[model samples]
Target: MAAAAAPKSNAPHIPVLLRPLIAAVAPVQGVWLDGTLGAGGYARALLDAGADQVIGVDRDPLAHDMAQGWGAEYGDRLRLVLGNFAQMDDYATDLDGVVLDLGVSSMQLDLAERGFSFMKDGPLDMRMSQEGPSAADLVNTAEESDLADILYLYGEERASRRIARAIVKARTEAPIETTLHLAGLIERCLPRSKPGQAHAATRSFQAIRIAVNDEYGALIAGLEAAERALKEGGQLAVVTFHSIEDRIVKRFLTARSGGGGTGSRHAPEITREEPQFTLKSRKAIGPDDEELAVNPRARSARLRVATRTDAPAGQSERSALGVPMLKGAK
Candidate 1:
């Protein structure tokens, strides 16, 4: 196979924490699976770093279409799969390693038609797979209470009730059909963002997108699938772009690594099971000043790595992972 070239400036999106992630798992050999595969930054980096084969998985068909231009250079060494990473193990098992970058891809957010960014004006469709229920369907049909729960639980938006009330009242007059319309409604409910703060609609958009994609559920499931698929000693590295996701990954690793803290005084301590992973770092790794200077989107990125243990893989309790649940969530 031909060697993959260095990423150019015109790339769709820069993969966050790539250098640190690859460096932490150097001597990158064997078949590795990249669960996100958006922008192909990590996949190309893995190929360049010396992976014999990279199974690039993405739920978005756009990712596969974009890869066709340059992916052929690597020939059989690069394989692109279209599907959610939650079922990653179904594609390959006993894998050498796995990499999952959580949250919306920069490419998806860049295209206004995809409806991921509040800054854009497009259809209110935030479906990563381009199939199934869209953000519009949820926003226009969901109950006000459900919307509030989604905003508060998923996005941590403190004024969730106010936003939900506004959405319900506006939808009564007309269906919320576009990104900007929903964003405009949300913006009216909140104070103008200070210069350094995020946009007024950022949190609401995030919550809706998460609901539309079931990202949190898929995240925990994908992590478990990676555990089941990885061979003993195989590395699993996950790059998360938000605090909630980082917390879920941290809690999952802590429990799986047998590092879950002792139970409180009232509750009897349960015996620790055989650890499924050995944490590569006790704390989450963040981008340094140099990376922040280069990619502002990487400012909130966090990378966590662990090596699979010989113990049998098992499902983790959803409540333990800190993933918030909601109905009619979008």
Candidate 2:
């Protein structure tokens, strides 16, 4: 089903690495996929860069609506799907190239009602798809130990136990329903510190959001699906924000590109399966100073690209990409 319409707002979503991302993906007059069509930014860029057609997938209905608006302008050049990129294989048939711009979008974060940001005073709802259980449910209902584990594992928060204990104690007296309340509680749990690094509640909020949305799970499935969907010689470009996400991309690309240490020459030439992809760039691409200056969010972003190789004869095409191994596969 088509996504509902987005509310009219003038806030501009600056696309990160517009030139480099377009150049790396190289969508040239063929079917291209924007796996995380956050603001329709990359899809619009792909169309402008001479792509014949683009398929945009987003879990957020708002993103699909934004794409629909762009579709009206582009006229048959775009298709917006109300689904997650993890299902790309189900939706994108005979894809030429795919770009997965991972992480939360500025649009969602900026909207107070979306509850993606602690800075905003809204309900504790961080689900990207808007259909899943809200962050409030997780925080209010989960056991203190489970909550602590979520914060520690996903947020990397060192004081997860203290924070979770505080949350459970607070919720017993009153449900932690608002973003600001939770943010305040987390802040209280943390020791006061210098400014500018990040908010005290940042990690805890991130952990909750990740847990509510199962973001890491979706990411692993999405990357595997994108790899399976691409045609031989087709490229895959991924932009990740957090270390957890970036590490997954790094390992996936490394495994497919055969970057694991090869054994010594003395050992018999161990011929594992042929590499599935050749590295497009030697190292991960970060946003340039210019892009970073304009968009502070670009600071944490990392881009990696690879080109698919021809499958061995008589082997299933899907097998060419190798087993879909993720760091924290669900």
Candidate 3:
């Protein structure tokens, strides 16, 4: 389940914050891994930026197929693997760097047949690996409370209970099987979006997609995997799209890099482990106006880059990172 890529591809998918990411991790070289590999934008950039080799890892089979069109030019320089980035440590130890772009790719979202977007009409299948219980199954079978928790916790949607109730009632009438079908039901429970706002079903769809794909779990595991895989001085750069995701990445880096302040007398300053990483910057980097003009998706994207150290790698508290978990610990 490992992959590498060539210097180029017909990847129309724009790599958001490409300039900023490259700038933040300047002098990119050695062996790098593109964990997301959605259209191979980051892989190509890293290869072009003088990485001796680039390993492109992605769980989606379609990504591998897409890479085939242009991956051969780099030959051994570009290796493409088929697997979740959560196991990135197993792909290659001592990697010079790891790049992860979280959430659904533009390619996946644009294609209605993939079902990642409620804006489009397609099957209720949002599994990134194209395997496992689909969104349709989750909607049709998961308990009402679970659905409510998913929307409220994972998505931060306030109307989760009402929408969950509606979903349970609607499915009883008939199985919720399509993107539009489910979106339509949720829309009825919410107010219409204004001219400048997002669609009514945006948050609900995001929550379900996150649940169906285990995105947050994969994200935390992937960060840990990056820590375990990177060599001393190697970098880990992540680009997140939402507040929750940004918060998780920010907290993970802060904790691992020893950014947490000393505790008071009542708490007693506990001895801390050797720092695993050093933050490139205290604040996340974002796209400039030029990049934003070219890619509006870059608006919400935040880049957080840090370099791994020789310290032993360990897990960060999940609650500290704000990873939303289901009630039954399912």
Judging by lDDT against the true structure, name the best candidate. Answer: 1
Of 1 and 2, the candidate ahead on TM-score is 1
lDDT of 1 by residue, 1-330 (tens): 111232343867878999999999898999999999988999999999999999999988878877887798999999999999999999999898999988877778888888888888999999988889999999999888999999999899999999999999999899999999999999999999989999999888999998889898899889999999999989999999888999999999998998766557887767666999999989899999999999999999999999999999987766777778676323
Give a tens-digit lDDT track for model 3, residues 187-290.
99998888989889999999998898888888989999999999999999999999989999999999999976545668776788888999999999988999
Show the lowest summed lDDT stretch of 10 residues, model 2.
313-322
Give residue 76's error in model 1 in angstroms. Answer: 0.5
lDDT of each: 0.89, 0.81, 0.88
Runs with alpha carbons beyond 4 Å of true place in candidate 3: 1-11
lDDT of 2 by residue, 1-330 (tens): 233346566544777776788878764668899988888888888898888888988889888667656668888888888788888989976678889888788888887888889898998888888886899999999888889888988888999999999999999999999999999999998888686779998899888888888887777777778768888888888988888778778777777676764457777776677777788987889998888887898998889988887753122223223332323432
On TM-score, the leading prediction is 3
User: What RMSD, rounded to one decimal, does every model reach?
Assistant: 4.1, 3.9, 3.1
lDDT of model 2 at residue 56?
86
Instruction: Give the TM-score ranking, best first.
Output: 3, 1, 2
How much is the lDDT of residue 122 in candidate 1?
94
